[model samples]
Target: MKKIEFYKYHGLGNDFLIIDLMKKRPAVPDYNKLAEKICNRSFGVGADGILVLTKSRRADCCIDLFNSDGSWAEKSGNGLRIVAAYFHSNYARKKKLAFEINDEIADAEIIKSGSKGFSIKVSLGKPDFETKRVPMKSNGKFHINAPIEIEKTKFPVTVLSVGNPHTVLFVDRFDFDWKELGKIIEHSKYFPHRTNVEFVNIVSRSKVVLNDWERGAGATGSSGTGAAAAVVAGVVNGYINRKVEVVFPAGSLYIDWSEKDDNIYLTGPVAFICKGEYLFDAE
Candidate 1:
C-alpha cells in the first residue's frame, strides 16, 4: 500500500482534493484511477474533483485536474483559487502566482487573506463564442439564444467556451426540474465534447443567481467557470453589464468581463478544510 498526501479545499461549496507532486512524490500507475478512487464520497475523501500539482517551466507550477468521475478537465476557476491558497499557505507568501494547465498559463493573485483561507482573483482567459471553438454542431456562426430541440421541446441556449464548453440558459425562476434538463443538455448531440449547463436568473443589472450542471461533476454548489459563462452570456444578450455578481446556493462569485482586455476575470474565496493521507494499493 502506498500513502498519498492530499489537501482539501472548497470555493463556496465546490470542493477539490489537491495532491502536490512537486516535492515528495509517489510512482503511481494511473492518475485516472487515483482520481476516481479518491474522489468517491462514500469510500474515499469526498470532493468534486482532484488537482495534481507538479513542477513547471512555463509558470510557477503546473496543474492537471480530473473530475470526480475520473474525467480530465481543461480548466476550473475555483480549482485554480484552491491551488493558490494551498501554495500561499505552504510555499511563499507572495501575493501573485502563475499556474499552467495543459500549457496554458493563468495568472492569480491573493487579494485577501485571513485565518479562514484566502480570496484569490484569477484570469480565466477570454470567452469565445465561435461555434467552431465551442465545438457545437451547428451551421450558423454563433449559437446566441438559439433553440435546441430535446425530446420535442425547444430550449433557447447561448453556447460558448471559457476554457471549456458551456451552454447558458436564462430563465425566470428555478421552479422546475432543471437538473434533469441539465443532464440531458450536457449529453446533447449538439455538443461533441459534452458541455457544462448553467441556468441563470437575472436579479438586477449587476447580479444574477445561477445553478450549475457540470459536465463531469453534476450539480455542484458553485462553479467558477459557470459564473463567468453566465456573465458573458448576459453581456452578449444585453441583459446585464460586463461585471456581475453570481450567486449560488452556498455563496457568490464575482466576475468581470473586461471590455479593454476581452478577458474574463473570476474572483472568489477559497477555504482550507483539512489535510490527510490516502492509502492506495499499488499492487
Candidate 2:
C-alpha cells in the first residue's frame, strides 16, 4: 500500500534504521507504533532502534530516537555518530556537524573517511551525577559504587545520566549470568525510568571490556552511550583512566573524558548496511 524509504546503519553491531523525515516528510500519525512495527526483528526491518532525522532551528538537524520496543530514548552515542556519518556523507559534507536531541545540542566531527565507512567523534555533553536527575529513588545522594541487591546478589553499581540514565557494574570476569542480572537491574525499582546497564571488566587503566544491555533493547553487541557511561563510571570510581578504550564484542570505541571541558567524547566507526523501501499499510 504505502512504501517508506529507509537506510540501515550500524556502529560496531548496534544497528539502527534511519529515516530522513526532513526529506520525506511522511505524515505518520503515530511514530511509536511505526517504530515498533519497523524494528520488529521477526516481522520487519530489524534493528536495535529507529532514528528519525528532522529539521531543527537550534541546530542543523534534530534526532528522535526510539528503541525497538517503541520507547523514546533521550539520547544515544552510537546513534548520534551514525546520524553524523549519514549527514556528513549526504547533506553537509563537513568535518564538523551539530544536532539537537531532547532540546540539547550535540556536536560531531568527521575525523576520517574511507570506502568502508566514516569515523565519527561526537560530544556526549557531560555526565550528570545528581540522584534526582538520574531519576533514581535514592536519598538525594550520588550513587557512586553503591550496592544494589538483585536476586540475593549484592552488586556494586554506579548510576549517572549522560542524556539518559545508566547503571554500571564492575565485574572480575564474565563467568556470571550478566544478561539475567542486567534485565533485573534494568527493571529494578531503584530506577524510576528503566536504565541502560553495562558490565565492565578492567584490563588496565586505559582499557576495559564492556558488555551492554540497553534500556528498551535488550542485549546488544555494542552501545555508544553505554561505553561512555561505563568509562565515566570507571573514572569516577578510580577504576580507569580519563581516556579509555572500551572493547565490545563487535569492536572497540574510544571514550575521552576531557578534564579541561568536562565533556565526554565518543569516537567510533559506522558502517552502511543497506538502503531499501518498506511497504506497509497506511493508517
Candidate 3:
C-alpha cells in the first residue's frame, strides 16, 4: 500500500482532486481505475474529476484529466484554472502560466488572488464548428442551429468543439425535464464520442443562464467548457453578444469569444477546499 497526497479545489461547484506528480511520482496500476475510486462520493474523496499533474516539456506543467466514471477527458476549463490556482499558490507566484493536456497547450492568467480563492482566465483556443472537428457523426459540414432528431424528437442544436465536443440548445425556459433531454443527447449516436450538452436560456445579449450535462459526469453545477460552448453557440446563432456572462446554479463565469483573436476565454473563480492523503496499491 502507498499513500498519495492530493489537493481539492472547486470552480463554482464543479470540483476536482489534483494529484501533483511533478516533484515525486507514484506507481499506479491504472489511472482510470484510480479516478473512479478517488472520485467516488461515498467511498473516496468526492470530486467531479481528477487532475494528474506532471512536468511538461512544452509548457510549464501537464495535466491528465479523468472523469469520475473512469473516462479520459481532452480538456476542462475549470480544471485548467484550478491547476493554475494550484500552481500559483505552491509552485510559482507568477500571474501567467501555461499547461499542456494531451499535447494541446492552453494559456492561463491569474486575475485575482486572496485568502478566499483565486480568479483565473484561460484561453481555450477557438471554437470549431466543423462537424469533423466537433467529431459529430454527420454528413453535413456544420450542425449550427439545426434540428437533430433524437428518440423520435427533433431538437434544434448548435454543435461545436471547444477542445472537446459540445451540443448547445437554446431554450425559452427550464420548466421541463432538461436533464433527461440532456442525457438523451449525450448518449445519442449522432455524436460518435459522447458530447457535453448545454441548455442555455438567453437573458440578454450579454447574459445567459446555463445548465450543463457533461459527457461522463452527468448534470453538474457548472462547467467552464460548457459555458464557453453556450456563449459561442449563442453568438453564432445571433442570440448573444461576443462577451457573455454564464450563470450556473452554483455561480457565474465570464466567457469571451474574442473577435480579434478568435479564441474562447473563460474566467471564473477556483476555491481551495482541503488536502489529504489517500491509501492505494501500487503497480
lDDT of 1 by residue, 1-283 (tens): 7799999999999999999999977988778888888989999898999999999998878999999988999999999999999998889899999999967999999999999778899999999999998889999999999999999999999999999999999999999999999999999899998999999999999999999999888999899999999999999999999999999988899999999999999999999999999997744
Collision count for each candidate, in order? 0, 0, 0
Q: How does each model score on lDDT?
A: 0.94, 0.92, 0.93
**Number of the top lDDT candidate:** 1
Instruction: Candidate 2: give the clashing pairs.
Output: none
Q: With candidate 2 superimposed using the best TM-score fit, by how many Å does residue 169's alpha carbon deviate from the native?
A: 0.3
Least accurate 10 contiguous residues by lDDT in model 3: 274-283
- List the candidate numbers ranked by lDDT, top first: 1, 3, 2
- Over the full model, what C-alpha lDDT does candidate 1 score relative to the true structure? 0.94
Model 3 lDDT per residue over 218-254, tens place: 8887999999999999998899899999999888999
Q: Which residue segments of model 1 deviate by more than 4 Å?
A: none
Could you estimate the TM-score for every candidate?
0.98, 0.98, 0.98
Q: Per-residue lDDT tens digits of candidate 2, residues 1-283?
A: 5677889999999999998988778767766877888899999999999999999998989999999998999999999999998888789888999999999999999999889898899999999999899989988579999988887878889999999999999999999888988999999989989999999999999999999999999999899999999999999999889999999998899999999999999999999999998876645
How far out, in Å, is residue 176 in model 3? 1.6
Model 3 residue 165 distance off true place after TM-score fit, in angstroms:
0.3
